[model samples]
Target: MTDHLILRPSGEFAGPVDEHTLVLGIETSCDETAAALVLGGYDVASSVVSTQVDIHAQYGGVVPEIASRAHLDMLNPIIARAIVEAGVPDSRIDAIACTIGPGLIGALLVGVSAAKSLALAWDVPFIGVHHHEAHLYAAFLEDPTLEFPLVVLLVSGGHTMLIEMQDHGRYKLLGRTIDDAAGEAFDKVARFLGLGYPGGPAIDREAVHGNPEAIHFPRAMMHEGLDVSFSGLKTSVMNHVRKHPDVSSEDVAASFQAAVVDVLVTKARRAAQQVGAKGLVLAGGVAANSLLREQFLDACVVDGIHGFLPSREMCTDNAAMIAAAGWHRLRSDGPTSLDCGAFPNLKIPGLT
Candidate 1:
């Protein structure tokens, strides 16, 4: 548990919340039950995540009912640990932030209910955060000086999209997945290859020792504007495995990973060039992929664009980024009413 606690204090709090203004962030948007104490917006006092990987591993993916139940059981302890680890009293927190959408509604409700209750009990504001928006804010958590006019590639198990961020709270959707997301495709292909659950890491580890070009996997959406298609690529992998019963899993994994990386890099770079973006930011679970990270950095260098990525810990679902984004929203727009509800398809406003 201690190993999962990423407590990095950024010296001092500087954003909307200061040392005196602390914010508690709760995130139960998915299989992870997370809580964080953030001073100001970027300064993380303590961040704790109770992952349901073990529970969901057998099922090959997250079961919404199981995930929600686990969150119900783990959220209180996680939140308590975060506050205790941060050395702050409940009364010290000025606001409570919770992920409110673009995720499993049952899981989201647990966090939102807790956050609203905490806010009411503590007499503080309650802020509802967009899950994907919070992922974008993760980049800012590590790099406070990172600027806007950037392109953000949000790739995760559930989402894949290229967003043009001109300023805070402003976004333009450039492209998205027509069917399966990149990470989802990775998981499905890994399952077809007889790899274990949570395929990203497993495939990544195996790909390290295999030949990426041994099997030529198709790269989707090379010329289809910014939007990508991964369903065909996944089907291709499945077909290859079925036809070549004796094919090496390592080679397939490497080839598949390479295909995904190639398409992601091409589209991301295209989006950046189209918008004349000064920086490129990658966020979400798939952003933690080693190959993706290396390839993204290489592309940024080739294009003379700055690249921003959060620490591996921040790349996944965590509440610190939610708090960071929420702090800004709280200061700028005030708190959300208790009537606000969770939204599974909550789209980030201003995106087309």
Candidate 2:
């Protein structure tokens, strides 16, 4: 994995894209501190991610203050490792990219500030990447030449939504969760079930040996258009557990996982068909869930649409996706102003 850029005119830059310039990416969106060097938009030279699971696991979930301070310590070293692993000096990096929005404010700043400092030092363009937008772009890293007009299902710890990508940086928000995000619900349900921290993985593992049909979990808002709601289902899980003291944790987990997966795949597929999409891309942290991934891909095949999924590592938050998205943004819109600051609630571009 070599990081080399050909200094050529724009007219002369057209050709195979596997040998593209190197972009440094930083991500501190939540509990993960990550950095990477990506070639072009799709070729990943090196990606480094530091997960804060052990620190937050004792607390049930991520604590904002702890998350930020951790990022401050982890960000720089991770960046250095990625640069070293990619076999490139900081001076040779062509651009810098960082997740700048829709994440913990303090955590987001750790990455954005580092990017600005690096850009100034290296004299490279600074690109700010939207967190959710980058999740969608993870699919491109797996295969950059994928057909457009694909619907992306981004299901993370804090967010879950269906977006139609008409093209790069252009999107149509089809639907979103009305209350708790899928991953959030997973955490809550898992905690109540004594399944432990980071619910998605916990529930996924337990549900494997359990019977999904053992319990009749409610699938909320199934016929109510594309928008989804998991709050009701979560409540139902709590109520059931409270009422049935002897309830099997595995059964509850399997049933709960089934409900969430059913809603997600159904809504995503319907949204794709509504927009005449050519493919369906499952992304974000929750995309790493076993059931959701299996059902999503099966649904896409049944519907006759291609399915695109990043590796489990890429499915979760990582700088490689941010770097990949940043590379495209740098090429399409030039550099973002260095004065731009972190936006914890920054909306995805082209959405109301």
Candidate 3:
């Protein structure tokens, strides 16, 4: 395969060309190999994702090496498909964006390398997007009118935190997990119960048939600051399973999920109040949890705050959100240097 793939712009479709710039986004932060063409940043033209769920299912969790290899194999085809579906030629892409950090280094490099190669070939701007920041911007993709000075709850497999967003690229971290993230805890607890890989969904489905209050799982840091601790909770679930061998897995899943939701919702509510936020935004993989979304919305209503939740598709790893964030960054700061490399612990620059 050639290092650069080229396509001619199709002139047949007479869409509104001057209204928005078309950007191609790539994301391989973890197990999902994704590419998307976004219009004016917010409007998704086409999004293609190749998931490694089945590949990692047997292992009960993602294997970093396998994920990176899968991205290398699938990234090209996915990008081609996104371009085709968008009906936009490669030459029409105004800029290219890729997630640069706070993820598996191997997986991130595959995307970053591809993005840099494409930018060089197309002679277009290359924007490096932070993984977590893209999650926050996912809400903006659906709600373009969403105002700033909002409280963002970012809960994924690797991260769990509350951020006060004052403006685009300006963030103040309010709280974070001291140990395992909410999703990580779910996966660990799911394994303890033999629930299977991708614990979040498995637990969610089973919890529907079980009693959330049947077992009392601890909700750490509930009365303290914005920080959370799920390691203790995970251990509690393990001890419960070990002591009560006959305890129903469904009840364990329900109770564990409830505990996590309780902490997340409480912290988000408190952060919003403290910051006087105009709205509360939920993003990242854990935000896809049914219980969490329901509880968050209810909490928002009780606290008299507007709640913004991206669709399930947007909640998970994807390139569209990266494109949306990159669009704004490109406009404000231009493109990053071609020498920019992947950052495993990349944080928003202005955030503390």
Candidate 4:
């Protein structure tokens, strides 16, 4: 494993002097075009995210081609606005950070290209941030008390993973979704139930009026290891909908949400206990789901573990988290090679 820490020049005065790093982060991996500036470790100096939901809502989901095009249009201005809001010039930024992978190919390229260009122009180091790593770091921004060797549950549109955060910039992947990320399942199920686009929040909103136990949905891998599998459960919900032609959609939505929460929280709790983690972190867009938040918090309370969650705004795809992560990476090591490019399938080095 490559070292991430960078040694600073010795000061005339002994002891440790505070080293502050500023990072400008760009995230265009999916539907939202985001940019942010972070200072030191946790302070979000500025954050700007441009949503393309209005354009994608008609289709009930994001279209990759359209999303890529939309990113191209909004990215430049979004980045500029973030810098303006941060009240800092490009020259002051210590490093550039961008999400490079595990997202739409074209969408990932827009941010990567912009980041590379900016790094070149500014003569700063470029750092590539893993999409999921940013999610875990989101917790640090919200709760500085969070410690290492903790379990991090990342629930999002394109990913559902359980990671062990051994230390800063170090991770161990414990488990992940076998098929269909949690939020992806939410979107597909919502569309199947005639709910609008951006399924997680939409479905979460509609589930309030229905009975969670109205339908008995299967919880996949509930009795097994921490690994999760939601695809079969999603199919089961579809089957339920088919069998009950007269059933209310509200019940279907509620039942479906219940099943998902059951498996998600249950597995998360299991992972936390198995690892004897000191802290539990929840992140990603699906982490914004009210039911999941409530259930996970409740479980943590019962299990006697510290639970950390990002502010609702930080739960989704955002550059603030990336900037926060990048600042840490920068302090550890200067930055990535200026020639760094996009990695659509970028992995957290040695994580798995």
Write one digit per residue (lDDT tens) for candidate 3, span 1-352: 1111111122222333333888899999999999998988789999898899999999989999999999999999999999999997788998898998878999999999999899899888788888888898899999988887899999999899999999987899999999998899989988888889898998999899999999998888799999999999999999998999999888989999999999999999989998999999999999999999999999989988889988999999999999988887776666777777788877675586
The positional error of residue 313 in candidate 1, measured at the CA in angstroms, is: 0.8
Q: Can you tell me which runs of candidate 3 are displaced by over 4 Å? A: 1-19
- Residue 261 in candidate 4 has what lDDT? 92
Model 3's C-alpha root-mean-square deviation from the true structure amounts to 5.7
lDDT string for model 4 (159-262, tens) is 89999999987788889998899999999999998888889888998899999899999998899887889889889989988998888888889999999999
Cα shift from native, residue 147, model 4 (Å): 0.9
- Regions of candidate 1 where Cα sits further than 4 Å from its true position: 1-20
Ordered list by lDDT, greatest first: 3, 2, 1, 4
Score residue 204 of candidate 2 by CA lDDT. Answer: 98
lDDT of 3: 0.88
- Model 2 residue runs over 4 Å out of place are 1-19
> Each candidate's root-mean-square deviation in Å?
6.3, 5.4, 5.7, 3.9
- Per-residue C-alpha lDDT of model 1 across residues 1-352, encoded as one tens digit per residue: 1211111222223335444568899999999999998887889999999899999999999999999999999999999999999997787888888998879999999999999899789777788888888888888888888777989999999999999989887899999999999889989987888788898898999899989999998887697799999999999988998899898999999999999999999999999999999899999999999999999999999989999867889989999999988876666556777666788878785465
Evaluate all candidate structures by whole-model CA lDDT and list the values in order: 0.87, 0.87, 0.88, 0.84
Q: How much is 215 displaced in model 3, in angstroms? A: 1.2
Residue-level lDDT tens digits of model 2 in 97-197: 89988889999988999998998898777888888988988998887778989999999899989999998878989999999999999999999988899
TM-score, model 2 to reference: 0.94
